[model samples]
Target chain A: MDLIWDGLRKALELLVGLDPEVLGITLLSLKVSGLATLISVVLGMSAAVAVALNEFPGKRLVIALMNTGMGLPPVVVGLFVTVLLWRNGPLGFLGILYTPAAIILAQAVIATPIIAGLGLAALQHLPPELRLQILSLGATRPQLVWLLLREARLPLLAAVMAGFGGVISEVGASIMVGGNLKGSTRVLTTATVMETSRGNFEVAFALSFLLLILAFSVNALLTHLQQSRRPR
Target chain B: MRAPLLEVLELVVHRDRTPVLDIPSLRVGQGEVLALIGPNGAGKSTLLLTLAALLKPAAGTLAYHGEALDTEARRQAYRRRVTMVFQDPLLFDTTVRENIAAGLRLHGVGAEEREQRVAATAAQFGIGGLLDRSARHLSGGEAQRTALARAFALRPELLLLDEPFSALDPPTRGGLLEDLGRILADTGTSALLATHDQAEASRLANRLAVMKGGRILQEGALQQVMNHPEDPFVAVFVGMETLLQCRVATTTEGLLTLALGGHEIIAVGEAEVGDPILVGIRPEHVTLSLHTDKTSSARNQLAGTVTKVIPWGPFHRVELDCGFDLSTWVTPQSLTELALAPGRPVVAAFKATAVHVVRKGHHGGDAAQT
Candidate 1:
């Protein structure tokens, strides 16, 4: 009880005092996750549009694979990414291991399927006649896609939020690929893990509190955007 | 005659190895409104979609302005000249103004021109006040109006309407039909409208085509097709409720005498004596009354009992068993004045010209089936 109360008191003090290291870790977490989410959104939405619009052999198999990927274990992804970026691995020629770029690459891989699965669902929920109607309006193929995306903007935004949420709080992949180098690749989740392992309970608590606030603030803004454009 | 603006030759559309539309040569001339009528699942929509270039026929050649649209580039260019309005008013999730302006934008019209056309079409369709409203918030009629405004804003050369008014209430459908008729005439835009309602087809189309079993059974001027349906199936489908199997007894001048049950009726046709003929008469053309004056120009007057009185809006469909079942429509006022009811004796009168005669051997021996 004393440990928890003391931790809480110190956590509040760190937050109020605006600890530079804690702030830096939080900003790094946001920057890496935000960039990963942006990349995933572009790739995921393209895949979703292709999957949702066209009919081809193995379509069901492809969709099943994406759905399976949505719930993939973070530790497993971390393991695979670590092996790929290792010095002797197949892709180590670029020499980007133990760096922030490695963390972003792994996070994007983790979030892509989640955004794509949700985006496909969002597009499929629209009326089937909408595509024909847009074509009847003389829309070219690209314009048709643009108009459909606009029509499905709400659910697509939800997909973005989900992708962002999936990566920001993830510690396993970030630690494995980023190496948690202080003042370089250290993010809020990895820093929290390190502080706890070092018996710095107060700092760990402060980091956890800061992580929650960060996630809440980003999600709150995205949620605001999603709700404001809702149909009356 | 003016060349046809659109021609469909030997078109066949299949769904999973089963052909749904097999139209052999149909044409729509410039400024012509052709209504295609058929029963449910008769492939009217498939035909319309094929004409709109939205559905590619498995086997056919579509000619636009006498040029074959064989390649994708030709088809795409043809599609830009054509537009369609489906039964459901599929509006995008945007403002009504934007929805109406979308097609113009796609056609690469300048923004100022798009706004002008959208504004004009909105006013024309009586949706001016709804321009700024969200499409999701529109009622069915309003959404449909927005859809029409969108289609018309493009000023397509050939408009294809697939039962655009079928999903509305009767009053709304009637109002929209009247406005659509006026719009088509004002713009001189040729169109092919597919619908199941014969009345709508008759009211809006200069020509009518009756489709059945994936084929165009008959096509001609509206009155010609309605009055002289080539087959018994067409007669019955076109709402000619009274079909009687009669044998020709004799001919005098331009009229032929036919034996109906025990009575002799005169109709305008030329059939050999002792030949079976199918006579069709619309219910509305048969007049019913209580007194048998016989002083009018009607050549056939038969007495019978009213077996059924079906209440139609502002009218009644009274079925009489005058040696043969003769269906006739009478106004409610006439019904009340004549005190018409079931089991009451009444006289049904019709002119010789009202009866449409089809030979028994025409169109695959379908005369006996009716």
Candidate 2:
């Protein structure tokens, strides 16, 4: 019981005092995940629009693969990304392994499918007649896509939140690719793992608490965006 | 005569290698409202899509103002010239003003002109007060009105409507229908409206095309098509009508006495004495009895033999050979109770108010069908 209370007190103290190292880790975690989420959103929305609007063979199979990727194990993604960025691996020429860039690449791989799957679902949930109606209104092909995306903005925001939430909390990819180097590639999740492994429970508890606050704040903003569009 | 504003030739639309719509030849004149009437799955929506160039017909050519839309550029231009509204309003997640202005913006109309046109169309659709309201918060009728206002804001050369009122309540549908008819007349915008409701087709359509099983069963002017359905399916679908071409023998008050096949019948409609008029009788409006009673105040009562009985859904269409040949709808129970079959004698009666009277064109009357 003292352990839990001690961890809570330590977490509150660190939060109140705003430790520079913990804050740095938090900002870096946010920066890497935020960039990764932004990349995923662009790639995912285009892929989703293409898949949702067009008719082609193997469509169901493609969607199934995307849905499967949405739940892909983070550790598995980390393993493949680690191999891909290894010194002797196929993509070693760029030499970006064991760095924050490597972590971003891994996180983006983990988040793109999550965003794409949800974005696709969000678009398909719209009335099927909407596309035809838009086209019949003299909308060009690009304008039609733009209008449809605007109509699906709410659900797509939820998709972005889900993607960010997914990567921000994942430790496997960050630890494997980032190496959890202090003051360099260390993020909240990886730092928490390292501090706990090193018996620095107070710092670990503070990192976890801060990570929770960050995730909740981001998600709360996104949820507000998703629902504020509803008719009162 | 000027070429039709739009013409479709030998059109065939396929879904997965199976043809769904096969229209041989259809044309719409300038400022003409052609109502495609049919039951569910009748390919009315498919035809409208093909006409709008949204669905590429497997076979056929679409022409606008007598020029074929042969190239991609031409087809795109044709599409831009037309607009369509759907059964669902499909409003965007925004204010009604934005929804109404969306098409205008896409058309590259300037902000000032777009606002002007949007307000004008909003007033036309009676949605002027709802411009700033969120589209998501609108009732079904209001949503549809906003949708229609949005389509008209573009001032489309041709408007395509696919059962826009099918989802509304009857009174709402009636109200929208009345307003839309007035608007169509006021704007003189040519439209191709697809609906299953006969009353809607009658109220808004100058020409009616009855479609069944992906084929046009009949197409003609409203009264001609309704009173003289070429196909029996159309006759039954149009409420099994019997038409009569007659001269107004005398006018007394709001009623008229008509001379028919060596018989005199009283009816009600606007006509000067001796004017030729076409009388439309819905089979359901006529009733039959084994013997006529003097107490009945029915205007026309003629004793005749049952010429035919066609089984149409629950009610059977009973054709009578009353000096002028008429048809009436009778239930199976009444059919059995009255022992009505071909060659059976009975008295057929209809009130003066039950018939529809339209002034005849110079082309004269079409042959009556049973």
Candidate 3:
């Protein structure tokens, strides 16, 4: 109990003074996760819409693949992305490993399927009358997709939040590909793990507290958006 | 007369391997309004979808301006010229302004022009105030007006409406129908509507096509079909009353005395003495009285037993088994006045002017069925 109280006092002191190390980790996490989510939203939303609206061969298989990918182990994805881009690996020529871009790419890969799956599910839930109404308006295929996406903004936004939460909280891919280099690639989750491993419990507790605050803020904002869009 | 702006030929559709829509041929002139009438699951909606190019026909030809309508590219091009309004209005998650601007944008109307036209249309449809309101928060009538404004903004050459007024109240429907008629006339935009409402059909359509079992059983001028139906289905569909054959015995002051089934009755229609004529009286036109009054405006009066008093709204339909089934509409007040009870003999009365001579055999082989 004394140790915990001492750690809490240290955390409060660090938070009050805007400690550089703690603040730096939080900012970097935000930057990396924000960029990764933007990329995921663009690619995942497009792919999801194509799968949901258009019929094609192997559609069931494709949906099955996405559903399966939703449960992909974080450690396994870390290993896979790391191996492909590490030194002496297939993409070693660009020497991108240990860079922020590497972490962004890995996190985007981890988050894209989540965003896409939710987007597709949201579109499928639309009523048939709504679909017919758009078609009757003489909307072209692209315009129809845009309309459907606008109509499904809530689920799409939820997907983005889920994807952001998934990527920001994940340490395996960030540690493996980002290398957790001090002052360079050390994000909040990785710094938390590193500090805890080194018996720096106060810093770890602070990072954990920050992660909780971030996640809760995002979730709260998402809930507010969803409720605003809901029918009265 | 201008050539038809919309022509559908042999539109046969299959649903779950069963034939659903089999419209052999239908044509709507440049400014004519055609009504497709049928019961539920009668392929009315399917036919409308096919015409709107939303669904492809299994086997048939669709032509606009004598040119074959084929291919998605061609269909989209034709669809831009021809717009379809569904029973339910689809609005996007965005504002009503965006929903109405969808078609205009596709046609490459500039922002200023689009806004101008959309505002004009919104005012026309009485939805100008709802322009900025999100579609997710609109009432049924508001949504319908927004959908119409969107469709009309395209200035479509042909408009297809599928039960557009089915969800609206009577007053709203009447107002919308009047607006639709005026719009079509002003723009010379032809329309093909599919509905089962008789009053709606009679009010809006210049021509009526009776559909049954995936076929157009009868199609022609609405009044002509109503007055002289070729089939019993068409006759009853158009509100044609039952035909009573009577022998004209005498003519007194424009009233003809007819002998019907060994009972003498007065009819108001002109007929030669000794000539057998048909007397038709709508159920609402006939009255029932218990006393054969000394002075009544009614010229035709006959005593008959109230065989059945079926409650129909504020009025009860009194069915008298007078040789054949003679149905008359009488209010509950009259039902009380005559102390009218089933099996009680009462007088069925009507004025000479109320008797109409519906000529026999106008079209089709449906005279016997009616």
Badly placed stretches (over 4 Å) of model 1 are: A1-18, A197-199, A227-232, B362-370
CAPRI level of candidate 3: acceptable
**How are the candidates ranked when ordered by lDDT, highest leading?**
1, 2, 3
Docking tier of model 2: it is: acceptable
Q: Candidate 3 residues A1-232, lDDT tens each? A: 7767776777778779899988888888988988998999999898898898777889999988887777667788889988999778998887889988889989999889888888778888887666666666667888778878878888878888888889989999999999999988999899989989999987788788888877788778877887684433
- Per-prediction DockQ scores? 0.61, 0.46, 0.31
Residues B175-287 of candidate 2 have per-residue lDDT tens digits of 99999999888888999999998888999999999999899989999978886665456765776567777778898998988877578778976678877666667877789
lDDT scores for all predictions?
0.89, 0.88, 0.80
lDDT for model 3, please.
0.80
Candidate with more favorable, higher DockQ: 1 or 2: 1
**Model 1: per-residue Cα lDDT over B1-370, one tens digit each:** 5558999899999988789999889999999999999888888988988887788889999999899999988888887889999999989887899989988988899988888999999999999999889999998889999999999999988899999998899998888899889999999999999999999998889999988888998999998889998777788878887887888899888799988778888899887888888888899889987777658899888888999999988889898888888898888889899889999999889999999985453245453333
Which sequence of candidate numbers ranks them by DockQ, best first?
1, 2, 3
TM-score of each: 0.94, 0.82, 0.80
Global lDDT of model 1: 0.89
The window of 10 residues in a row where model 3 chain B has the poorest summed lDDT is B360-369
Ranking under TM-score, best-scoring first? 1, 2, 3
lDDT of 2 by residue, A17-87 (tens): 88787778899999999999999999988899999999999999999999999998889999999999899
- lDDT (tens digit, per residue) of candidate 1 on A141-207: 8999998998898899899999999999899999999999999899999999999999998888878
Model 1 interface RMSD over true interface Cα atoms = 1.7
TM-score of chain B of 1: 0.96
Question: Which residue segments of model 2 deviate by more than 4 Å?
Answer: A1-5, A12-18, A228-231, B241-281, B284-346, B349-370
